[model samples]
Target: MNDEQLMRYSRQIMLSELDYDGQVRLTESHALIIGLGGLGSPAALYLAAAGVGTLTLADDDRVDLSNLQRQIAHGEADIDHYKAQSAAESIGAINHHCRTQVITERLQGEALQHAVEHADVVLDCTDRFESRDAINRACVAAGTPLVSGAAIRFSGQLAVFDVRDSAAPCYACLYGDSGDEDQLTCAESGVIAPLVGMIGSYQALEALKLLSGCGTSQKGLSTFDGLSGQWRHFGLGRDPHCPVCQWRR
Candidate 1:
């Protein structure tokens, strides 16, 4: 690390668990965040501000006025702009030192698979199950760690599925192909602004832990009910018969 880098990340380096080596690991890591709406906004901001070396942000939608309430990565002026491009600009302004790449097109099929193959860690801040499943499949195939989060109508859930650990479960283990489409989108239900922030921040934290080799990640379902102000967590185990992980085993 250069003198400026040392000074820039001195706070993280101060932690005994994240000394120079750990900080360096973070600086050398790359993260791919799919989706740029509510969850992606804070996740990308925190990661960039923390000096994550490179971030690849993907989203196909344009920024809309409705997004202003929660998508902090965009502004009023960004209305009608591609969200991925807008978010890249937002992150660049926050930390010019961090490399940011924008994928303005939807991540699907081979394109999605290719992105995950190159990332050290992938964040599924996306809003739909189809995208979530695609991301999860790629992560599992690549043996990469994934931190997934979701928020809608005062309810939020976060989980880490690490294919790097043979014993850890993939997302498919928790929600099979039968997962209801109605339950996957934020459009059908409204989300509280701070709920997305809280969950997205946790996603960034988990990504950092996995990247820096620091602490244990939220490697299971961590659910929060903001309306009732209740938080609950549950452990997840790999399905011995899980089709994906089982093949590797």
Candidate 2:
């Protein structure tokens, strides 16, 4: 690390767990973040500010006026810009030394698999279940750790699914392949801004821990109900019959 780099991450490097080596690992790691809305915004910001070496942001949506309520990565000036591009600009402005890659196309099929395979950590900041499921499958297939988070209304959820641990549960095991919640979305229900910031920031924390090898990751489910300001943590185990991981075993 150069003099500027050292000074840039001085505070984090001061942590006993992150010291010099851990900071180096973080400076050499890459994180793939899906979605550029509520959760993705804060997640991207924190990752960049922390000096993540490379950040590949993927999103096909354009910034909308409504996003100003919680999508902190973009401002009114970015209103018609593609989210991935807008997020990259915001993150770049925060930390010019960090490399930022913007994928303006929506990730799906082979493209999603490629992205997850190359990333040290994958963050699912998306809202739709389908996208989350696809990203989960890719992560499981590549044995990459995933930091997943969601926020809607006054509720938010965060979790880490690390397939590196044989006993850890893949997302499909807990949520099932398909369910009744397909119709639910934050757009219709509305959301509290900080609810996303809280959960997304946690997602960034998990990603950094996974990347730097510096602390215990969530590796399970943690739910937050912001309306009452209550949080819950639960242990999760692999499902012997889960199609995603069953064949691997």
Candidate 3:
């Protein structure tokens, strides 16, 4: 890292837990963030601002006016623009040193697997169950770290899965292969704006932990109730019969 980078990350480097060495690890790491929606917005921006070496931003959808209510990375001008590209521009503006790779299409199959395999950490920020399922399978197959988050209505959820550990539980372990709550989306249920910011920020925190080794990533399942202003943490274990992860066991 250059003098500018040292000054750029001085505050984070001040921490004994994440001193200069940890900052270096962060700068040398790569993170793959799928989706550029509510969750992905803050996750990408925080990671970029924290000096993640490279970020792969993937999303196929274009920005819509309704998205402005929660998607913090996009503005009115970005409406109809591809989300990946818009988020990439925001990342660039926040930290020029942070490199970004924008994929304007949804990634799946071999492409998804390839992206997960090469990343130091993967952040699953998509809304659809199919997208989350595919990402979890890829991460499990590649033994990659995954930081998953979701928010709808007044509830939010977060979980970090280090698939490199055979004993660690994955997203599927928490939500099954085909999650029944497909219709439970912001569009359908209506979400408060800051709820996503809270979840997305936590996802970034977990991703940074995975990359910088500053702290242990979150384990198990964490649920947040915005209405009650309460958080619940529950232990999560692998399912012996989980179709996506059973073979690993």
Candidate 4:
């Protein structure tokens, strides 16, 4: 770390868990974030600001005027722009030292697998169940840790699936392969803006912990109800019949 880096991250480095060595680990790690919308926005910002060495942002959607309500990574000027590119610009503004790669398309198949393999940690910030399932499969295949989050209406969910751990459950184990075509989205059912920020920030926290090996993984599922202002956490069990991860057992 140079003099500038030392000063820039001095606060985090001061911690016992994230001393110089941990900070170095974070600086040498790569994070893959799929989605540059509500959940991906805060996750990418925090990861970049925290000095993740490399960030790969993948999102096929363009920034809509409605996104500025919760997608903190983009602004009015970025409306109509590709979300991946807009997010990269925001990240660059916060941390010039953090290298960013933008993939302005939805990733799947070999491309998704390659991205998962390269990343030290993957953040599944996408909204669709299909994308989440694909990401989970790729992470499980590559034995990479995944931080998944979702927000809709007044509720949000978060989970960490460390496929490197034999006991951990993959996303498929929790939600299964069945597609919920009628699932409510932020667009369909109005969302509270801060709900996404809360979940996305937690995703970033989990990624940092996984990357630096500084904290215990928050295994299982965590759900938040904005209306009730309460959080519920439950242990997750691997399903024996899970198609995506059954072979692991």
Candidate 5:
């Protein structure tokens, strides 16, 4: 780390868990964030600020007026811009040293697989179930760790799936291959402004932990009800019939 880097991340380096070595690990890591909306916004921002060496942001949609309500990484000026591009600009503003890459299309098939294979950690901040499934499959195949988060209405969910750990349960183990038609989106049901921030920040926290090896790997589902200000956690186990992770055993 140069003199400027030491000064920039001095606060984080002071921590016992993330002392110089962990901060170095973080600076050597690459994270792939597949979404630039509600959850992806804050996750990317924090990761960039924390000095993740590289970040690849992917999203197919353009920013709209409504996104300003919860997507903190974009501003009014970003309206009509591709979300991946807008987010890259925000990350660059926060940490000039953090390398940023943008994917303006919905990533799938070989493209998504290759992205996951290169990343040290993957964040599934996407809203759609199909995208989440594709990300999970790719991460499992690549033996990478995944940090998944979702928020809609007043409810939010977070989980960490480490394909490197045989005992870890994957996203498919919990939701299976079911279509997400029954799931409600912020566009349909509406979301409280701060709810996305809370969950997205947690996603960043999990990703940092996984990258720096400074904290325990969270191995379950954590759900939050913003309306009631309550949180619940449930341990997850591998599904014997899960097509995505069954072969890992």
Candidate 6:
């Protein structure tokens, strides 16, 4: 919008699909990114770099030595530091234009709902099913668009669930919210470093599309198999019995 912003994002503005208008939209958006680990790392950085105006990063966990292998946002000096704090610092280093808000504690109940309500878009980078379920519910209630990404053991998946659309499927529709399913975490099962980076980048891309209105909102499940280097995508339907989104149907 100004001289500095125009020069900073000149290349992006050059794209006809996402020209000056799209860049302005991105600069006016606010995105909430939950988790600051594997998936959150890249998602946060790219969104900041892509000119998302404001970013709220929430994560209570402190950085561990094990995270450096894949959590690119934190450095060796950040070990034992709160992940959200560390990541906010990293984002500031790259884009002074990006206003970064750090939530150093786990967001729950009213706090979670407030965060989702304030955000123009939400990115579910958390690994736990419980956390994912909670985020999905809050987004559904607030009618906020959500970009969810997951990666474990050389595999990753991405999905966008916009509860604002009556026909769109929420995360709960794709994965039941019962929490009875066996959840394999990256810590327990192990994950390739690049796998999460790839998925997280896609999450950032989807968020930009939703905010800037540059591309069509993607509706479906995209799964990536790192072992075979194959990508499979298929449309996901809203489950009539889905506790989170069934009412909309």
Go through the candidates in order and give the clash count of each: 0, 0, 0, 0, 0, 0
Q: Which segments of model 5 are wrong by more than 4 Å?
A: none
The superposed Cα distance between candidate 3 and the true structure at residue 29, in angstroms, equals: 0.7
lDDT of 5 by residue, 165-213 (tens): 8888889999998856787788989999999999999999999999999
Candidate 4 ranges beyond 4 A from true positions: none
What TM-score would every model get versus the actual structure?
0.97, 0.98, 0.97, 0.98, 0.98, 0.98
Clashes of 4: 0
| Superposed Cα deviation of residue 149, candidate 6 (Å) | 0.3
Q: Rank the candidates by lDDT, best first.
A: 6, 4, 5, 3, 2, 1
Candidate 6, 23-91: lDDT as tens digits:
999999999999999999999999999999999999999999999999999999999999999999999
Clashing pairs in 5: none
Tens-place lDDT per residue, model 2, 76-138, is 999999999999999878999789888999999999999999999999999888898899999
Error of 6 at 199 (Å): 0.2
Alpha-carbon lDDT, every model? 0.90, 0.91, 0.93, 0.94, 0.93, 0.94
**Tens-digit per-residue lDDT, 4-98, candidate 1:** 88998999999998899998898899999999899999999999988899999999999999999999999999999999899899888987888
> What does candidate 2 score in Cα RMSD to the true structure?
0.9
| Model 3 per-residue lDDT tens digits across residues 1-249 | 899999999999999999999999999999999999999999999999999999999999999999999999999999999999999999988999989999987799999999999999999999889899999999999999999999999999999999888888888888888787645878888999999999999999999988888888777999999999999999998888888888885
lDDT of 4 by residue, 208-235 (tens): 9999989898979999999999999999
Ten-residue stretch with the least lDDT total in model 6: 174-183
Model 4, position 141: C-alpha lDDT score: 96
RMSD of 6: 1.0
Estimate the lDDT of model 3: 0.93
